[model samples]
Target: MGYSPTHFKSINPYNEEIVCEVPMHTKEEARQIVQNSQEAYINEWINTNYEQRAKLLNAVAKEMKDNLDYYALPMTEEMGKPINEARGEVNKAAWAAEHYASFAEEYLKTEYIESDATESYVQYLPLGVTLGVLPWNAPFWLAFRYLAPALMSGNTCIMKHDSHTPLCALRIVEAFTKVGFPTNVVQNLMVGHSLLEDVIRHEYVMGVSLTGSSKAGAAVGAIAGSEIKPVVLELGGSDPAIILADTQDLEKAADVVVLSRYINAGQSCIAAKRIIVEEPIYEKFIDLLKERFEKLKLGDPKDESTTIGPIARRELVEEMHEQVDKSVAAGARLVLGGQRLDDMQGFFFPVTILADVEPGMVVSCQETFGPIASIIKVKDEEEAIKIANATDYGLGGSVWTGDVEKGKKLASRIVTGQVSINGIVKSDPRLPSGGVKKSGLGKELGPHGIKMFVNTQQVWVGPVKS
Candidate 1:
């Protein structure tokens, strides 16, 4: 009936210091939590009116704003995100909450159908409890992205956050509680990874949403599938940034590409992993990128002046280094930083840039989740599009060109979920975000996201005259 004393420590990636030790919930505790959530969904949340749901969502947003620094600081400490970027993530989460609150009514409105019956319509109804398996990167934003939409659509959620960021997970639950959500409407289950399948298979859980690696997605997808439960996956992406020869300003293009490739030390799933440039401007683009990489200051993430921070974990640093080493061995030229910073105390990897990258190289072909940029040269727009589509992951991509129409046209040809023209690829509350192929299975954000876990029921009445 109670949780065990087992616990896990949240280690600061910058200094390897223990930020906090959190108790892990036992299997029974987790099961009870899920049951409580289900009961709350069936008894209270389902009957809660849309107006009241919108108000609660807005209150959560206000709570996030009121305690922005409190939430942002722990995120940076638990994950290696730069403090400034962490702050931005907090703001983004608040915006998502508010965005859903403002538009849920319109998005979930009933649709009337013309038929022989006297009255017929389709209604969007909640599907009870949803399980969200969240990742550590952008901890707050990723969790809130799904939480806001699910709650606004009248479904309760039980989140199983990454083990490495327990503090961040607890903080989110606290925020919900502060907003005066009904008891058990939103809860956090701090359990080990092995218990995830049990939670997924629980009878009361109707849906599951995950934001993590491709491998994790596959495993969870299989589990959710076996039970005939609906799932939404936002997985890994080796997204490409294509630069055409027709670009008017090379400087602007280079700036956008650099930020997209290296933000959050390049741990993002949608970060520009592959940089495909037209042959005419390849050399110029590489030089500009190199200059930008050199300008980045790798230091403590807590420092506001630091632009680049350490990879989140020690094993990730080794993995990223291995990728760089193997790529160089396979003939990819390292133009800038390619080695880990030995002098630093934590897992600090420098801003690395690789040129002459080819298809078979690890850097070009795989999802390199670090501060490393792979530059692939192509002959023309045809080759650019060809190379961009040559990956298994198709989450997101971007096109850089002077002509907006040309960029949009090229974006249409890219095989991905979403694409941006002359701008960094990012998820917006106004549009649906997710991937095609192996990147992800379902969409998130926008109206589609709020409806992902809802059931569409049809209502009909016969005519009085026979």
Candidate 2:
């Protein structure tokens, strides 16, 4: 039959305006992704040697780096993510390709082992075609996170990206092909989420990975579980940035909070949504934060001077506005920067700080994926950890203390899958990225992430000569 991607709009979150109307793939068309990837996997890609796969991955990373500005510009235009943020995602996203390029060989190699009876061996095998239902906020990074690892493990990828980010999903497929990946190694489905459950139920889809909300993750988990197939989920986070009274540099702590929350206009799952400061330094922290927020230029992403820009979508801006309103209704006070910039033509919610934020407050428990942080004062590290761990999320957290031992100790106690001491941390290809509790199951990015889709095989012999 005939097929065409459905129409979808991406609004400039800065000024509440339409940025673009993208064509989305229909369910019928979406089915092609899995079919094509499956064909590629079993036909040609599966047989490609590890050296060739690594070479292709490295070429893709190089292609991405070479065209960083081209990708970043479009990302900023479509998603309203600040220019630098999009560029950094490009750089960081390339790490996956680089990582797989250098490491996939050793990772997939068969290893010698010994059993009591005789000789033994261990080898890794790849799963078949995998479906990745991706998110928009960090489109390039998330899409490739699955691509790099899955391909490294010998599994071809079929991706159904967020409708709001169809261009990003398509562009990534282009990147793969440009880097010399054979046809269908990574296929982008321009379809709607309506087709997700049906596609995951497809026999060709051996595994799946999703990065989105908790509710969404649960739904995917249920489907994948029922199918008895594997899935990796990296869900939501209201990560906390804990500040100690004895922190050596209060200004640096404030700066860290500002940068962490405002990146991508705070549309990150691991963004520091909560700022828990010890009471002794709370007032000073607030003052410095206000000063820094004022200095942050909020305007056009292409402008070299703009540090913050419109959010990704208008609905997100409205939602963020409602959150601040509900927080006020619930007795939270704004220390500085709340509400939308009315004159701007994009979806722009000003960087906001809600003080006296309590657990049930709108800005407290909720994962406000905007430039908003709920600030709470704590008497000591115990309360800081308590407040930090109070949420259903366990994605990421940070501890600020001059004492290295105390910082490390506090990080150990926090429930998050990743934490940083004295600085804000993003997921590195070197460190596995996943979460505990409600955040997600399984992992992505590092060696463990790459191996998640791999099958371990053991072979045994009757006896040994020795």
Highest-TM-score candidate = 1
Flag regions of model 1 displaced more than 4 Å. 1-5, 464-466
In order of listing, the candidates' clash counts read: 0, 15
Per-residue lDDT of 1-466 in model 1, one digit per residue for the tens?
A: 0123477577888888888787888899999999999899988999998899989989988898888889999888988789899989999999999999999889989999988778889999999999999998889999989999999999999999888888899899999899899999999988876888999999999999999999999999999999999999999999999999899988998998889877898999999989999999999999999998899888899999988888888888888999999999999999999866888877888899999999789987789998889999999999999999998999999998889998888888999999999888999887899999999999999999988999999989887324
lDDT of 2: 0.83
Off by over 4 Å in 2: 1-5, 12-23, 464-466
Task: State residue 165's C-alpha deviation in candidate 1, in Å.
Answer: 0.4
TM-score to native of every candidate shown: 0.97, 0.94
In the range 1-466, model 2's lDDT, one tens digit per residue, is: 0123457666555444555666776677777778888899999988988888888998888888999987776678777777888898998889878888788777668888767647788888998899898988888988888888788889998888776766676678888888678998888766655777889999899998999999999999999999999999999998999999888988888888898988887889988899998999888888888888778778887776788887776667788899899998989888888866877766678888888888778788889998887888889999999989999999999999989799999999999899999999688887788998899999887778887887888888876546
